[model samples]
Target: MIRVEHLCKRFGDLMVLKDINAEIRRGQVISIIGPSGTGKSTFLRCLNLLDQPSGGRIEIDGEDILAPKANVPALRRRMGTVFQSFNLFSHLTVLENLTIGPIRLLGKPPAQAATTGLELLRMVGLAEKAHSLPDEISGGQKQRVAIARCLSMEPEIILIDEPISALDPTMVSEVLAVIRRLARQGMTMAIVTHEMEFARDVSTRVFYLDEGLIYEEGPPERIFDHPQRQRDRDFIGKVRSLSYHVTTADYDPYALVGKIEGFCEKHLIPHRIAHAAQLLAEEVLGVLLTPLAPPRAVPTGQIVASSALAGTASTGPPLTVKVTASPAPSGPTHPDIELVLAFSEKQRSLEPRLDGAGPPGNPLETANLPDDFALNLIRHYAADIGYERVGERNRLRMRVQSIAGREAVAPIPLVRQCGAGLGGGHELDSATDGDPTEPDRFGRLARRTPATGMTPHQRLSS
Candidate 1:
């Protein structure tokens, strides 16, 4: 239903998109994934001529959607876009929001438009919220309503830009369910998303983009699971540029599903309950543009002291602290989420001080500075203090501190930051005795050892 040929877009000196080409078959979903700033959204916009491309062509049903004689508005009415931020009119009622497109553009009678609006609301599971206003509903609900508004026009193809990126994890399923419903009905779709799993579940084909062009294209299984290109892997790792779409075909159209399934099986990547839980939490927290450096694994029982925690001993659960990972499942995805409820963002930036940024102004004033480096204002600081480091290889151990059981003397959350190390990884071990339970601890795949089973780090200590 949609075709993009050698599409390109540039803003001033920055080239956001380049030489992009793809087709969106009716009733199939296409997702474009890549790292931040690679022009995924720009590509989507240029398809509808929302962002005039510096070059290239877009077609629908064999007609140029971007050509001058094209009925652009009519074409757009066939394509709906859902934004990361719910761009609903705050002043409009839910009913009003969905009806605006049909009544204004389709010139439908208000009563008919309203009836259709209510049906769309029901389609997206927001029929009850129709009388409510944007602010009155949660972000997830608002996005659903936004999608319903888009569907209200009964478009042939849809363009989505991070629609679920702002939703909470649990809420993400609700929105995704609605989208899945749409896909099943055979609507053509082009979506740009960082929701890796969702991209896997629904897209027909996936495109891996980098530096303004599609570096690679394959089934979602390859793009999401075993991406062939390094740039594709890095894009998915750092910030995915995934496009899972398929060319319009009349025959067996489940090509995207096969790719996703194949990749999942090869990687031993199971859709485990734990994986689902992690994805859910991510919706609550948000992902980062760049992965946070692995926290150095100080040996267990080592204490980190922050005066800030001196009084945080409320008889409750662990204070929220955000943990970050590379691949994500679904939800509003900020790289970082407010976490370790007791710890503040200021404390998280405890890298060595800049030459002159000085104390980050507020909260630190009440706590005692690390007396040793307190005077070194220009020196940035990062420490693996209590975490044990193997004598050789830095043998980085990724530290994951779940709010384990609390003791009366539970140590205050101390500050730790990664600095100046590009190639680093940490081991996650089941045994605190310095042995990783699984071979690949936190993505640090075990390196081959000689006949001896022990790592060099262990051998040296022995």
Candidate 2:
């Protein structure tokens, strides 16, 4: 268990993390996300006092780690960390990577450590790659080796800092799959990532960091759908736009269903979304286009309202292109729904980033939710929103589709139900609301519990 409170870290004049507080429990996988330079790496290091917090309290189990009597190095050994850059020694083989930490740090005999080292290698599926040097393998394989090296230490928690961002698009999924596998094995992890689909699927909880503070934190469903803060919404909107790229800019800016804005710019590496999709579709459809693009645009027949009902407006466009969001519901289970929205370089008065992320006075608050309850929220939303999973076998085949028959569904889309964007995680006991007095999964009553008759929850005898 890790407990951090009022954490603040500053380098020179820049304050990277501010007033951050969170409690991470065992068997939980928490993913942190933010734009570049938002202090994600710093926070990870602070877990083991790698970068001592300027002022904050850190506790491991029940001990005050920041206390003068605590052994920082010992604490670090109890926690393992992996980086995006395969920090594996390029000159050494995979076996050497795992053995080095144990032999050197734990002062174990090389042969004895090798026994454990080989076991660790197999855990990350790299026993065959054991003799291979870092330079001789793929990025994903090298990262696997790095992970094996960390496991050799037998740590309780793993801290991964953007471990897949440096890899190419195809390789990203392979590495994420390995991490997901690790999660299944019940390793507690605190990860910093940009892979929205991966994070959404595997995370026990997610934290959105903004301006050096924890802007929002909750289950994936709450954080993704009923985001409380506008900044948080903008962060996800831009990310989803880039991942999906199919939605139109004028629709709702936040609509994200059809007709992407075509912007011309010299954006380099990690591959541009629009260009990649064009290449992938070239053999079939040449280059995809919409009325939103310039010069050689095609016009639509008649505009349709987003829904047939009245009052609610159609922030979506007419040209409905559909993509399945899947693996027959039996595939890898969690795949990212990537989308990107671009526009003409000359266009103005339209920065779609401001859509759902608009500044508002509301903040979502969801009480304690069971470990896997969020997945239910996702399935509920995905089915109704016309989001069919669209990739191949062992993949998240959910595709981007047109907004023709799509309308926000009920009991989900808490943003529409609440009239305020807030679904921070807990379920509503009644269809209309959730009582604040219920006990959390750990059997502790909420702060609002009444003094009488509520004797925690009872065990269900099967």
Candidate 2, number of clashes:
39
Q: Which stretches of candidate 2 lie over 4 Å from their true place?
A: 239-462
lDDT tens per residue, model 1, 15-39: 7887888877887788888887889
lDDT of 2 at 172: 80
Which segments of model 1 are wrong by more than 4 Å?
A: 237-462
- Assess the local accuracy of residue 167 in candidate 2 as a C-alpha lDDT between 0 and 100: 86
| Top-scoring candidate (lDDT) | 2
List per-candidate RMSD values in Å: 19.7, 20.0
Error of 2 at 319 (Å): 37
